[model samples]
Target: MSNVELTNMCMIYDRTNNRVLVQERVKSWKGIAFPGGHVEDGESIVESTIREIKEETGLTISELEPCGIIYRFNDQTGDKYFVFNYRTETFSGELLEETDEGRVFWINREELLELKLSDGFKERLPMFFDRKFSEGFGTWNEHNISELKFR
Candidate 1:
């Protein structure tokens, strides 16, 4: 059986403000990015997503609309990584100013591209905003070079 790791990320959009919640991570993968985390064993994907968002942003979210997925494969180890992407305009609770992950806050949707984004996050944005494509596939070699495609 092939080794596969599952994770999730979500775009929490505040339609009223034309902004989205983003985390300025201070952890392994640093920079501005959406809030999410690994799927716990025995937890459903959606359940895990909801839990992660609440933990990371202190906001209880619902009515998630599946956006797309970002998939990566390590050629050297034959391991696969998948990030299930989602976006929602439904959420509640006061947003946390900071967490162990990073500082969480809102940014204007139009200005998203202007900020420094986490690695590979720039390419993944289309998946969150565009409805036509549902996948961002990438293959990484031993050298860490990758070729990505959207479909």
Candidate 2:
């Protein structure tokens, strides 16, 4: 029998540059990742993503578009995460490091491919660029992430 874990976050794309926002953790892993985090109690995925964006980027996600949902399963351990990915079309405020997660940077679509990131995100982000905004929870079960695939 297999089970799953869940995490919440937002995927903010820079409208002006066609780049995406990410932060590089300063600690051990020293990797880059998006600016959102786990969903807090009593908060919806939308709420968590907005709050995380503000905290990590020092900006407000004013107009968020529901991009889609994803589920990522680890091939090694057979573990998984329920991911809620969103598109922030409109926003305000300057981005700054507001947490221990790391310093932030805006990376181009091609550059995103090279950065050392949470493997899950790197594998799943392509769908966002393709506009596969499906409605439903994503099910990641084996290092296999399907755009409109849900479980």
Candidate 3:
């Protein structure tokens, strides 16, 4: 069996405001991105997503719509990483201003592309908004350069 690491990310949308929740991460892999984190052992992917969002953004989210997935394989390490992507417009609770992960805020959908996004995050946008594509596959070389393609 191949070694794999599972993680998740969620795009919390506000339909009424035409915006989505974003995190400007202060930790590793910092930059503009969605709120999410690793799935703990024995936790379902969906459960982990809910927990991560709550911890990072202080919101209780539900009715998740599974949008797509992004997977990457590292040639040197022989490990594969998978990020199950989801989007939901249904959420409740007080929003957090900041967390150990980063600062959380809502931004207009159109303005998202204008900001400096985290590495590989720009390519993942289509999977969230474009129904035509449902997957992102990335291959990482020994040099750590990645080539990503969507389908």
Candidate 4:
């Protein structure tokens, strides 16, 4: 038997300025990722997104647009994980100096592609910034991306 975990994650984008809130995860995940975290046991996806952004970036999320989900596969453990991604442009509060996750900062859209990003994040970059409202799905392994689909 295998166990699956559900995680709620989001990317905070300031559309007006063409920037995004990102974290250089130096400890745990060890890569550049958006500001978000796991969804608690009893929390809804929206609630988890809001709470996680606040905790990780010190910014309170106001609006969230459903983007899609990332389905990750662990070949060694036979475990599957689903990470729900959301897009938000509205938030409040000052950015944090440090977080349990890592150092946080806003990056310009063009420069984001040049940074070393997580495998899944790099594979799904289009979905994060696409203007048309839609959903996306992707499957990835530890070091490589298997497939990516968007609608």
Candidate-wise lDDT, in order: 0.90, 0.68, 0.91, 0.79
Which lDDT tens digits does candidate 2 get at residues 1-151?
6555555566687768888887886653357776667777778778888887888788899667766666655556677667677777577788785467788877896788798886455645655676644634433344465444432
What is the TM-score of each predicted model, taking all chains together?
A: 0.95, 0.71, 0.95, 0.83
Better of 1 and 4 by TM-score: 1
The residue-by-residue lDDT of candidate 1 on 1-151, one tens digit each, is: 5688899999999989999999998985799999999999999889999999999999999999999888899888888998899999999998999999999989999999998899878888888877767988888876885857989
Per-residue alpha-carbon lDDT of model 3 for 1-77, expressed as tens digits?
55888999999999898999999988967899999999999999999999999999999999999998888998777
lDDT of 4 by residue, 1-151 (tens): 7778878778898888989888988765678988777778889989988998899889998779887776767666677777788888889899997787888999998899888886557867666777442545555566765665666
lDDT of 1: 0.90
As a TM-score, model 3 comes out at 0.95
By lDDT, rank the candidates, best first.
3, 1, 4, 2
Candidate 3 lDDT (Cα, 0 to 1):
0.91
Clashes of each: 0, 7, 0, 0
Q: What is the Å distance of residue 145 in model 1 from its true position?
A: 3.1
**Candidate 2 backbone collisions, by pair:** 70-138, 71-138, 71-139, 71-140, 72-140, 73-140, 73-141
